[model samples]
Target: MDVVVLIGRILFALLFLGSGFGHLTQTDAMAAYTASKGVPAAKAGVLVSGVMLIVGGLSVLLGVWADLGSLILLVFVLPAAFLMHAFWKESDAQAKQGEMVHFNKDVALGGAALMLFAFFAHNSDLGLTITGPLFHLG
Candidate 1:
């Protein structure tokens, strides 16, 4: 079960890790797309979000301040779901479907982040973490 938990954590972190890398490495291309999506200061947004994802993903991956990491991710994903992938704003059917997928994906990720935060904040057993639940209630 512990191994399974580690595996799940690794898998979940991979997406953000890779995407964050892309955001940094492919800044111009990513920022252009973000601009097209009407994100103001897209380049700055991309850079900040990229750093946020990297920090959050690494924290979660290592179980270092994981509760805080989970919160960081939740913060990133929730508004991004609407600002970046507004399915309702799409006019074309296929575009709407694609946007819906992205939107739902963000929402789902947000929910998962919240769950991880709950587990970490509660000091639940999360296997294979170097150090965990660095954020704690008094």
Candidate 2:
């Protein structure tokens, strides 16, 4: 379990860090890309990217508030994968035709890792509220 957690942490963390840095350092390109995808500019794209990197990377590495981090990553990645990538239009030949293909894959993988980490780590001495169900009824 510890090893699994560690591996998951590393995998998830690297992805978050890479993504965040890419978006932050390439703000002009990223913003242009986002606008191309119909996302509004004037919103601080670089700031948001930086935040995603810091928050997501830290949470995964420290395993603190990882669930929240995972959830956030999940939210960010899904539409990024489908909407931004146009996944349905891709064939094997065209799949690797653009940067969006890779970005889409990376985001999707990060989202999946986040979800798994959240689910598995839930059993690792973490506080989870169980409501409306009882193993023992008196």
Candidate 3:
């Protein structure tokens, strides 16, 4: 793999890795935030999302089953964009702008996940994988 790809993967994985750790360690705070967004069983949601983020982040970072990992990330990100960052529902200008930024960031992350999924979908000539591609659509 190119050094750039490795670096990008590390950088991308760090975002989720840190957030996932935070979710588990600060469950109370994260659950409160999720509950504020009207998520039912907010604590459960936080815990589930936390595990998902950690698993996916590790998979991508390690380039093992990256296709599946990217799909997991895509699944997590798309819904989160709508469910948590519904900027259109915000009335206050500041809140709306804040939500919009988060929403856009999630959307962009989703897109990146898709790109990674495609890159890993075709064959197992992966530059960095040990036992990979594992499962893909192509």
lDDT of each: 0.90, 0.62, 0.89
Cα lDDT, model 3, residue 116:
90
Q: Write the per-residue lDDT of candidate 1 for residues 1-138, one digit (tens) a residue.
A: 888877888898999999899999999999999999999999999999999899999988888888898899889999899999999999999999999999999999999999999888886566788786876664
Ranking according to TM-score, highest score first: 3, 1, 2
Give lDDT: candidate 2, residue 106. 60
* Candidate 3, 74-100: lDDT as tens digits: 988999999999999999999999999
Q: Higher TM-score: candidate 1 or 2?
A: 1
Q: How well is each residue in 4-76 modelled by candidate 2, as lDDT tens digits?
A: 6667667767877887887877878877777776666523755685677767676666666666666656666
- TM-score, candidate 1, is 0.94
> TM-scores for all candidates?
0.94, 0.67, 0.95
**What ranking of all candidate models by lDDT puts the best one first?**
1, 3, 2
Q: How does candidate 2 score on lDDT?
A: 0.62
Model 1: CA > 4 A from native: none
